[model samples]
Target: MTPATIPSRFGLACVLGSALLLSACAEKQVILPGERESVRPEADLSESRIRLDGNTARAIQLPAQRVNAEWTQGIGSPAFRVDHAALGGQLQHLWEVPIGNPDSRRARITASPVVGGGLVYTLDSGAQVSAVTPEGAVAWSTNLTPASERAIDSTGGGLAYANGTVYISSGFGLLSALDARTGELRWRQKLEANGSGMPLVRDGVVYVVAGDHTGWAVDAGNGRVLWQIMGAPSVTTVLGSGAPATSSDLVVFGFGSGDLVAAFRQGGMRHWAEAVAGNRLGRAVSRISDVTGAPVIAGDRIFAGSHSGRLAAFDLHGGEELWLARQGALGPVWPAGDSVFAVTDLNQLARFDASNGSPIWAADLPGFVNDKPRKRGETWAHYGPILAGGRIITASNDGLLRFFSPESGQLVGQVEVPGGATTEPVVANRTLYVVSSDGKLHAYR
Candidate 1:
């Protein structure tokens, strides 16, 4: 991949205003994933469809298997990648549980529900955290902040599961660890930077990208501050970027400015960082280069997509560009077998060649309000195209969960969720969980 001189818009630096002067910023220099040459076509704003190259126009075989038993983090796992998992006989709705207080709409659900330890964990719109049975029995529900702290103002943050613990990052600027089974608070730490999305836990560390366009590494066990990394802030961002993906020794994630960064998982030591936003076209939010998609780590390569920017692969170790394409996506792209599936900015669900970043197939989905989702604004859909069984399952705001063939992108099955899923759906123990913004948890078996 050829190196670009620009930076990513994922980090929210625009709102930084004068705060940019209060802190240090990384120099804007893009380092590619590998030594390979750039083979990507220029981004075309005119189409929601992907033009296939000769190799991509033909048939491609994708892996039909998935990881059984867990959707540990917001993006499946800390690596942000999972194989195809098996599903059951039917997509029947088993049960539903209210997520947060029903009376108030001020707090919107922002985090995907994660399942672990046979219990589904959710952080609701009202800054309330709950753990329940896969069958929808409420084991416990608790507020994350003080009574005075829970307000209609801010709604960000999510939950992550690892090592029998649940890590919570809140728009209230609080990070806390709770016992997975008991809902007991282990520790909580306040931050100068507010948490934006789901906090990822790997190798005893919890990684967070705050609203301030900064990255943090918190000790998962004790909630200690290990180290922090700062990136150029954008006046605006694409919903606080995606959850960071980790592998080898690097923790990589995108920022509001569309920057893809690689840092040591431990000490925040820099490996190589670059801008994922390929070109700066317009000043409109349409020009925002935020990489809202989480990075997918497979072997030595990391796959990522940006909103109104490029979809590219980079070398995990040395930060070299492998290949790129013009496709803007907000949710984390799913990589399985040999194909990577993405729900793009144009409302099209497409698959790309994992090895060379080639376009394999493109299919459209019903457009959701996510078309205009942003931080400090109204909530949007958490489109889930999770690969399971031999199909891809995705949820929308219309109380629907649709399934499609992984091979042909053909419609296979569909189901209606209660109140619809505002965030992405998560699966564990052969059960799929969708949490609606209305604080309702719908479980399908």
Candidate 2:
């Protein structure tokens, strides 16, 4: 479809009325027996000894007002033709904004949509950073200097909004802080010559990994560089690497090329760096490989995945390896009750015990639908499985949004977008927001 088509699908009129009718017929929440009794299902929570208290439960609760949240860069889209009304949510086509113009020069948007106050943010391959409203109007667009001679796909970097500022990174190697409301630039810093990982902000600090096997912690409140650590050995001499994670007082990360997991006292000096062994696949590979995903911090242990299919956990305090799970792992992980969700290029959805990385359930999923007609047996890949309201909401690459039961991983309902989905589903109030690859923003109940 041409960019100007503005397909009838990307409008509120087409879906709003249908969604309102469905929302008017609300489904009463069923009080399950598990809520009243303490009889925990073996798989209800991850296989950790730490008991989940009220605080933990409350932390994951849906907020009264929707806050822009992105677990990973983009949400998962399902590979199916769907009816929007059946998904148990209202569906409204908000807006369809075009990304690269008719000219061939265009940037592929791998950065996830960042929403805050009243706007959404994303970065495209053309080194163009864009901000838009939920209604699909462009707020501002700023182009940055390209990092290298070759174009790098910015799929993994994540965006964060804190205080009154917006934090964004270019896979090419740049981090900038901009005003949240207006797209005014506050400060821009070249974290490294090359940047591939997303920045994670906590407290008042921004933790990020540099393309050159180094990690830096900067004060978010003022954009001051607090400390920098030579994460792994030099990539030229050794197979250099670094993966970052953080808690209130501690900063955690792993470096397999240097064979270490290190911790630093927040706002203080680097405390210690301990080695973590290379798995069968080790750290570096022939092409496009490294430790890239953000580490998930749960209780006292921090869990992470390496480029090589190894999922391991380490002590948040001592930087010691607690448990390691060996499996054909792929992509970033999402932690729900007791199970963490991951999808592979082979179209497999696997849930593992977050504590020990033991497999609890695994299933092969359908691949995404391309713009062209799908040939027989062709499939699309799953991008994300966001957990909310006892259901897993996922977007497929082919522009379909689906709802699945967390209990069985079975698809419940789905909606198809004229433009396929490239971002993760954002759930606020009772509305689900999804962005499509063709630059269309969709809202569903």
Candidate 3:
């Protein structure tokens, strides 16, 4: 693997208005598996500069929470937007099963758990894919690692399901179609480079991005590349790639180079490209401009964020910039009705007005481990601000699943994850599935 293909283990950190200042000094104690820390005083945000916009704060509303039957893709849908999914009752601890090998120094699990056909799917750091039942039983398992000396280090691919087939992208430069029920391989195609992100399948076509930043459209039935386009190359990127988001006619992909490109869904003709690159002053991690989170398309707008301190929305038709914010999104921006919720680079879960990109409210999540200052201790990374059951849901590397009020950005409730989550949680049929960094599949009802 080349330098750019290797996943970086660095935590994303940057100053976002007053949130970082408040969170950095705000003292909160969280007990890890084998460690405990003293309680610290909470920073007073009453006089802080970041505040909800008065004009839209009172009018903000989210779509009604609806029960989603299946989460077939990593981001829930081809558009990468699952607005207000219905997760019923108190999320009681249900069952847990080991998925595969956990994250090591050589590889890490970056793909979110995908649920479909009554089974939860996960891709571990070693390129192993496992399917688990709702009762936490391993139904089938398959290894996609290529037969090569360097294949042991392969990591960071994702899964998507459509019809009765599971589409898989491998870090070993292969895309394979598998039987969703039997785990039998149907077809496989070799790509020009290793896969960087999850595959998105829609209407008999599969879309994926490679490590070289190339977008490919493949036939879902047979693993044949229909069309492919090369994107601008970058030497440095965060850990993983963002899955491409698609509408009826267009598919938008975010590259590690901070380029957001939109191409025709059927053909690979470039529609437009925009750079989502910007850096926070004095922050070294902010220099990486990878769009680690998948771009989300809701209605007529496209929302995406980069690690380099930029959260932007663009017109879906012309790819024109509609609004932009300075806070880099740590994960995919959850676009509800009038607001967009994101776990920001500052370790704060913030709500932004989807209309004008105005700050609504920001709630601080766990930042540095042991509540120590950045660089002095390890920082807890957060993923997924998905709106479920009338609350904003976010999973942390600190083994906690937090729920926040969508209306106020206040912490409402939290649950302990067994081994700490490595990626975002996915909900299917009113059940939540989270993949822990220790390679366990945790299911909650």
Candidate that scores best on TM-score = 3
For candidate 2, the per-residue lDDT at 39 reads: 61
Question: RMSD (Cα, Å) of candidate 2?
Answer: 21.9
Residue 360, model 2, lDDT:
63
Which is better, 1 or 3, measured by lDDT? 3
* Model 3 stretches with alpha carbons more than 4 Å out: 1-59, 76-81, 149-151, 370-377
lDDT of each: 0.74, 0.54, 0.80
Of candidate 2, the 10-residue stretch with the lowest lDDT total is: 76-85
**CA shift at 187, candidate 1, in angstroms?**
1.0
Error of 2 at 258 (Å): 9.8
What is candidate 2's lDDT per residue for 176-274, written digit by digit as tens?
787877777787777765554556676777766666666778888777888887766545311112235665666665443433345454544666665
lDDT of 1 by residue, 113-221 (tens): 8877878888776578899886678898777775676456557677888989999888788888989999998999876766756788888999888877788899888
Q: What is the overall TM-score of model 1 with all chains considered together?
A: 0.81
Question: Ranking under TM-score, best-scoring first?
Answer: 3, 1, 2
User: What's every prediction's RMSD, in angstroms?
Assistant: 16.8, 21.9, 15.5
